[model samples]
Every structure is written in C-alpha cells, then in structure tokens.
Target: MTVDYSLPKPELGAPVRVSPFIRFCRWGLLFAGIAYGMKRQRTLEQRETAHRANLRAQKVIWDEEQKKIATQRTREQLLQLAKDVNVPIPADFDTQYPPA
Candidate 1:
C-alpha cells in the first residue's frame, strides 16, 4: 500500500451573491437590536432618575426631623445635628433657640 502526502488544491468557482430575503432579514435584525438598546437605555435612565429623587426626598425628611428636634429642645447635640444637616441654619433658629 502506497501512502500519498500531497495536499488537495483549492478550486475557484463563480462569485455568489446574497439573496434578497437574507439581506432583508439582516437589516431587520439590526433594527431590532437598535430598538431593544434604546428601550433598555430609557428604562435604566428612568430608574436612575427615580432613585435620585427618592434619595433627595429621604434627605429632606431627615433634615426636617433634625430641625424639628432642635426646635423642640434647645439642646447642643440636636442643634448641631440640625445645623450640619440643613446648612446655614434658618435665621429664626438663633432668635428662637438662644445658646445655653
């Protein structure tokens, strides 16, 4: 038995063209992907906005609570907490709660 180590040669044929249906499918897939990406981006942006607004609302509530506590009692700790949380204490704070 003789063994042949020769490689097969490449063959060239007529050029092939894409079918109309396949081209249409390709464009359809591209548009679908773009639409999905836009939808996902909008969803994520809306979620982020809601999250920020929620955080702002929580901070406002916390600030108000601190100020309320400070107003109820002219204690040093509560007053400090309100000042730090609300920033530039309200003008009435000085007149209403004199330092001890």
Candidate 2:
C-alpha cells in the first residue's frame, strides 16, 4: 500500500490551552522581577558611594593627625639640639625654621 502524506496527523493528546488569567499573572511576575532588580542595583550603588565618602573623610582625619605629630616631634628635636649646643631657643622658633 502507498502511504498518504496529504492528510493531517491526529494529535496524540489534548491541545494545550493557556488561560488569560495565567498569561496576565506571568507578565505581572516578570515586571515585578525587573523592578526588584533595578531597585537592588540602585541600592548597591548608593552604598558604594557612601563607603567611598566615608573612606575619604577618614583619610583626611588621618593626614591631619600625622601633620600634628610631625610638628610636635620637630619641636622636641629642635629643643634638644639647642640645649646640647648651649644656645638659647628663639621665641619664634616654629616660624623661624619649618619642618623638613
């Protein structure tokens, strides 16, 4: 017998039907996921900006402290040198000689 290729084959199972409500729910879920991802990204960027600002402030404070310490040490060294050489320390010593 010759096989006929013109007729449409019968479906093995029931045709799948997607309801309107299910389609709407799927779209809603997709939108919600996109919104949540955008919000999360913005939050992370804000946190990074705040962290950088805090680091810069800390660095400024540290630099000021270092300068103060260096100046105090220089003053102490100058006093010791003057005492060793038997020379009187000048009244405007800090202005007369700056730290190297």
Q: Quick one: best lDDT, which candidate?
A: 2
- For model 1, state the Cα shift of residue 8 in Å: 15
Candidate 2, residues 1-100, lDDT tens digits: the string is 9987898887688778999999999999999999999999999999999999999999999999998888888888888999999999887886866654
lDDT of 2: 0.90
For every model shown, the clashing-pair count is: 0, 0
Per-model CA lDDT versus the true structure: 0.85, 0.90
Q: Residue 54 CA error for candidate 2 (Å)?
A: 0.6
Worst 10 residues of 2 by lDDT: 91-100
- Tell how far residue 49 is off in model 2, in angstroms: 0.6
**All-Cα superposition RMSD per candidate:** 10.6, 9.9
Give the 10-residue window scoring lowest on summed lDDT in candidate 1: 70-79
